[model samples]
Target: MSPSVSVTCTSLSFAWPDGVPVLTGLDVAFGPGRTGLVGVNGTGKSTLLRLIAGELAPGDGVVRVTGQVGYLPQNVTLDTALRVDQALGIAAQRAALHAIEAGDASEGHFETVGDDWDVEERALATLGELGLGHVGLDRTVGEVSGGESVLLRLAALLLRRPDVLLLDEPTNNLDLYARRRLYAAVTAWPGVLVVVSHDRELLELVDRIADLRSGGITWYGGGFSAYQEALAVEQDAAERMVRVAGADLRRQQRELADAQVKLARRKRYGQKMWENKREPKIVMGARKRAAQESSGKHRILHEEKLAEARERLDEAVEAVRDDDEIRVELPYTAVPPGRGVLTLRDLELAHGARLTGGLDLRGPERVALIGRNGAGKTTLLRTVAGQLAPVSGEATAHVPLRFLPQRLDVLDDELSVVENVARFAPGATGNRIRARLARFLFRGARADRKAGTLSGGERFRAALAALMLAEPAPQLLLLDEPTNNLDMASVRRLTTALESYEGALVVAGHDLPFLRSIGITRWLLMSEGELTETTWEAVADPA
Candidate 1:
C-alpha cells in the first residue's frame, strides 16, 4: 500500500448468507482526503464502508488501514439510558478526572486520565461544533430528538480524532440546521473521511467522488456536480459510439446482402452456361468448381465482417447507461383550479405544534413544510391525514388524501409489489395494477418481488406506487421526508412521479433542492410551537 493511502481493500469479496454477492474481487483504496462514496441504493456502498470500518468481515481478501478508524453507521441508535458523556465514550475518563479533582489521585485514575485531562472540554467543544452545545453532558439520549442523536453519534466519532473516519448516510435524518453543521465539520476534516451518502449537499463537500457500480469503483475528480458533468460527457460519447457502430453494422449487413446477390447471379450464369453446353465438359467443370469456392469464400468473409460489426455495436451499446425514469399519468389526481384542498382552523396538533392563524390550501397548491427536528411537522401531517386528531381545532381534507410516511410502512413485507399496489387499489383489476406499477419502473418480475426482498430504492418505489395508485386517486398528498434514504436516481424518480401529480402536495422535508424541484408554491415553517407561511428566501436563508 502507498503511504498516502489511509485505507486499502485488496481483492475484496463479500456475500450475504443467502448467497447474494455484493462486492466481488473489488480492489480500491482511500487516500488521505475526503471521499464521497455514492451509488444507487444496494450497490454495496454501505458494505464497502463497513468492510473498511471493520464492522463487517469480508468473505475473501484483505482490508488494511494505517491508523485508528471511527465509523458512524447509517442508522445511529444510542442507548436511551446512557448519558451524553457516556454516549460520547468519555464517561470513564470524565469520572477519573473528577476523582482526581476530588483528591483521590489513585494510580488507576491517573492512568485513565493520562494526557486526557481535557477530554470533557474537547467533547463539549465537538458537541458545540455539531450544534449540540445546548445538550449537557449529563442529559440522557432519550431527551434528544432523532436528528440530534445522529449528530451526537457524529460528535462521538469526531472526538475520537481517528485517522480514518467512515460515515454511512450521515445526513439521513438531519434537518437543515444539523445538515449545515455536518457540512461544516466535513469541510474541516483533516483525515481520510469516506462518507456514503445520497445527500447532494453533503456529497458536495467531499474532495472526490468514488462511484461504486457493478462491484467496481470509478473515481471522479471533485464533488457531485463535477461527477455529474463527467458522467454527462461520458454518456454523450457512449451514445455517439453506439450511433457510429450502428451505422457500421447496417453498412456491413448491406454489403453482405450485395455479396450474396452477386454470388447468386454468378451461380445462375454458371448454371445457364452449363445447361447450354456453352463450354467443354472439363472447362465447365473447372469454371463451376472455381465459382462455387469463390462464392463460399465471399459469403464467409461478408458474414464474418457483419458479425464483427454487430459485436462492435453491442460493445458500444453496453457502454451507455440505462437510467430509466418513471413516467406516469395521474389525471384523476388533478384538483380543479378553485377547489378547496385542505383546511386547518385554529389547529393545535396532538404534539403541541399549532398553526397560529390557521391555514387554507386551495387548488393544486404545493406546500413545503420545513422545521427543526421535533417541531411536530410529522404530527401536523398526520393530523391532516386524519391519523391524529388536533388538540382543540379542526384539520380536514376536502379530497381523497394519502400520506407517505418516512418509514414507508405502507408496504407489507410478505406482499409482492403488485400485491401491495393491489391492496391500495382494491377495486382495480390485477392487470390494471400491474400496468400502473410498470410506470413506476416495476415491470414484470420486478413487480412480483416480495417487498421484503426489494432494495431501498425499489422499496421506495413500491410504497410510492401504492399511494399514487390508490383506489380513490388521492388529490391531497402528504409526503414526510420523501427523499430520506433515497439514492439520487430514486430521488429523480420521485421528482418525475410528482411531475405527473396534478394535485395539492404537502411535503415535510429538509431537502431544499428536492422541494424546489417539486415546484413548491407555498413554504411553511414550523418553529417554537407555531406554524407560519414563509417565503423561499426566508426558508433558504433562515435568518
Candidate 2:
C-alpha cells in the first residue's frame, strides 16, 4: 500500500458461523479522496465498512489505518437520555470552557478545553449545517425525529475531524433538504471518505467508485455514472469473449467429427485392399496401425481444445453478472380507469393533520408523496391503508390494499420468509407461496430462512413480497420510503416489481429518481397539515 493511503485492507476474509462467506482474500487501499462504495445488497458493502471501522473483526488478514477513523453506520440509535452536546462529543469541552471563563480556572479545565475553545459554537454550527439548528445542545435525543437522529450521528462524526471517514448508507432517512446538506458536506470533505450509499445524488458527489462484487472490488474513476458506463463496457467485452469461445468450441467439435469419419473410411478401404491382395499384407497392416494412431491423436486433440474453449466461455460468463431481474405478474391487481381506488373526504388524521378538500385516487394513478421531515406523509399513507383511523371525516379505500412501511415492521422476526408470506396469503398453498417468493430472489432454502437473519435489503424484499403476494391481491398499493436503505440493485428490483403492479400506487419517499422511474403520474406535497398538488420539476427546484 502507498504511504498516502489512509486506509488499507490486506488479505481480508470473513464468514458467518453458518459458513456463508462475505469478503474473502480482499485487498484494497483507499487514498485521500471521496470514493463511493456501491454494490448489490448482501455484497458486504456494510460489512466491509464495519470491518474497516474495527466494529467487526475480520476472520483473517489485517486492516491498517494511518489516522483516526470515524464511521457512521446505517442504523443510528442515539440514547434518549443523551444530550446534543454529548452526542457531538463536546459536552465536556463546553463545560470546561465555561468553568474556566466563570471563576478560578483549574488546570483540568484547560486540559479538557485543549485547542477547541469554541467547541460548543462549532457543534451548534455543525448542527445548523445539517438542518438541525432548532435542536439545542441541552435537548435530548428523544425530542428529535428518526431523520434528525441520523443527521445528529453524522454531525458527531464530522466533528471528530478524523483522517478517514466511513459512512454506510448515511442518507437513509434524510429528507431532500437534508440530503442536499449531506451532498454539500460530501463535496467539501477533505479526508479519505468512503461512503456506501444507494442515493444517486450522493453517489454522484464521489470522486471515484468502488464496485464490490463476488469477493472482489473493481475501481472505476469518476462518479456513479462513470462506473455504470465502465461496467457496461466490461459486460460488452465479456459477452463478445463468450461468443468467440463458443464459436471455437463448435469448430473443434466439427473437426473431431470429420477426423473420425475419415479414419473410418481409411480403415474400410485398407481392409478391402488387403482382402483383394491389392497391396502387401505387411504394408497394409502398417498403414492401418498408423491410421488408427493418427485418428486417436486427432480426436484427443480436438476434445481437449473443445474442453478448453468451453472453460474459457464459462470464465467469460462468470465475469458478467447474471443480472436476473425480479419477475412478478399481478394481472388481478389491475383497476379500470373509471374505478375509484381511494377517497379521503375532508379527512383529518389522528395526528391532527386536516385535509379540507380531501384527496382521491382514480383508476391506476401513481401518486408520489413528497414532503419534508415530520410532514405526516407516513401518517397519511397509513390512514389510507387503514392502519390508522382518521381523526374526523371519512377515509376510504375502494379496493383491497397493503402498506409496506419504511421500517418493514410487517414481517414477524421469528417467522421464515415463506411463512411470513403465508401469513398474508393463507388461501395460497405452501408451494404457491414459495414459487412466488422465488421470484423475489428467495429460491429454495433461502425462502425458509428466518426474517431476523436477513440483511437490510433482504428484509425489505421479504416485506414487499408479503404485501404483494397477499391473498386479496391489493389494488391500492401503499409504500412509505420504499427505497430507504436499499442498495442500488434492490432499488432496481423494487422498480421492476412496481412496473408489474397494475394497481393504484402511492409511494411516500425521498428518492426522486425511484419515484420517477415508477412512473408517478401525480405529485403530492404535504405541509402545514394539508396535502397539495405539485409537479416533478417544481419539487426538484422548489425555489
Candidate 3:
C-alpha cells in the first residue's frame, strides 16, 4: 500500500446544467488521513466529492490526484441479478481458475488468474472483514438485503485498494451492524479518505473536519467535538467584535449629532452679528464665509467616520453564522391526556411486518420507532396514516393526522411553496398563510420559489410547514425518516420545532440522536414480524 496520497482542487468552478451556481473559485486539498467534509445541504459537499472522483467534471480549473481513486456515492443502486463475484469484479478470474483446476491448462486462464491465485480467499476475507461472511461470491445479489448490497459494493472497492477514497453519505441507508462495520473499516484505512456525512458518530472517527461554506473550506483539527469547540470559541469572538463595532458606530453617530447642534448655534450667532452692524460689511462677510467653510469641513469628517464604522459592523456580522431559525407555535394541535390518538389491532401490514396482538397510542405520546432496514417501520407508519391500509387488521386514527414520508412526496413539484401550502389549507387566507410560512423561513419571494428548485433542507422545511400548518392542525403527526438527508443544523432546527408541538408524534427513523432530542416518551422496536416495546439502552445495544 502507498504511504501517501494527495487530492487537490485548484480554482475549481462548477454549477448545475440549469446554470444554478454552486461553487466558484474554490480551492482545497486532502492528503493522507480521513477528513470529514461537512456543510449545509445545498452548499455543494456532494458536488465537490463527485468532481474529485471524476464522476462530475468541473466547469473550470484543475483537479489533481497522485494515485488511484475510488468513490462511493450517497445512493447506490446495483443490478440485483448480478452474482456476488461479478459485482465484485472477479467473476471472470474466478471462472478462469476453476477451468485451470479442471485440467483445461489454457494460457488465457493463467493470464486471467495471474498474480491472484488466492483471489477467492482474499475476496472471502474482504467480505468477512465487512461483516458479510455469509455473502458467498457465487450468490446472486438479489439474495442480500440493501445494507448487504452496500457492503458488497465496498468490498469491490476494497479489493482494488485505491490510494484515494471518497465517500458521500455512505451511512445514509445502512443499518447499525453495517454502519459499525463501515466505521471499523474507516478507522483502518491507510490512504487519503474524504467523506461527506451528517452521521455524528461516523464523523467522530475522522482525523480532521473540513467545513465547506460559500465556496471555501475551513480546516479544523481533530474530530467533530473539537470542530464544535473551535466554532463556539470563534462565534463568541465574532459576537464580541460585533458588539465593539456597534458601540463605535453609536459613538460616531452621537459625535455627529453634537457637531450638528454646535454648527447650527454658530450659524445663528454669525447671522445675529451681521445684523447688528457692529463692523464693516466686508469684514463681517469674510468672517461669515470663513466660518461656513470650517463648518462644511467638520461635517464631512464626522460623516466619513460614521460610514467607516458602519462598514466595520457589517464585516463583523458577516463573520458570524446566520443559521435560519424555526419558531412556530401551534397551541391548537394539543390533545387531552386521555384522548385516544391511534389504535392498531392484529395489524398485519401490507409489507409483511405484523404488529402482533395490538398497539395503541393515547394522548400526546411521542413514540420513536427503532429498527434495522426493511423492518416495516415505514409500512406501519403509512398504515396508520391511511396512506396504506393494513393487510388483514384495522389501523385507525381518532384525531386529525398528517404523514411526512421519506421521499417528502406531499408537495407538488410544479407548484410554488405558497401554492403548496395553500393547497393544504384551502380555507386559510393568503395573508395568514404567508405569515405562517415566514416562521418556517420562507419569507416573501422565497415562498414563491418552485418546490422543484428547492434544496434538500428547504424541501423538508417546506413539507413540514405544509403539514403542521394544515387547516385542521394535525393532532397526530407521522414522520418516516424525516432527518435522512438533513444537515446537523437543520436537524437541530427540526427538533426545536417539534418541541413546540403539543400533539402525539410517531416518527419512524433510525437517527437515534434526533429521536432522543425530540423527547420521545416511548420506544418501539420493529423486528422479525412483531413490534416489541424497548428502551434506549436496548436500542443502543440490541443483541
* Cα lDDT listed for each candidate: 0.91, 0.89, 0.91
Tens digits of per-residue lDDT for model 3 on 194-257? Answer: 9998888889999999999877999999988899999999999999999999999999999999
Q: Please name the candidate that would achieve the greatest TM-score relative to the true structure.
A: 1
Candidate 3 clashes between residue pairs 3 or more apart in a chain or in different chains: none
- lDDT string for model 1 (242-355, tens) is 999999999999999999888889999999999999789999999999998998888899999999999999999888877889999999999998889998888888878887
Candidate 2 error regions (>4 Å): 1-5, 270-281, 411-455
TM-score for all predictions? 0.97, 0.93, 0.95
Clashing pairs in 1: none
Model 1 scores a C-alpha lDDT of 0.91
lDDT of 3: 0.91
Model 2 misses residue 352 by how many Å?
2.7
- Flag regions of model 1 displaced more than 4 Å: 1-5
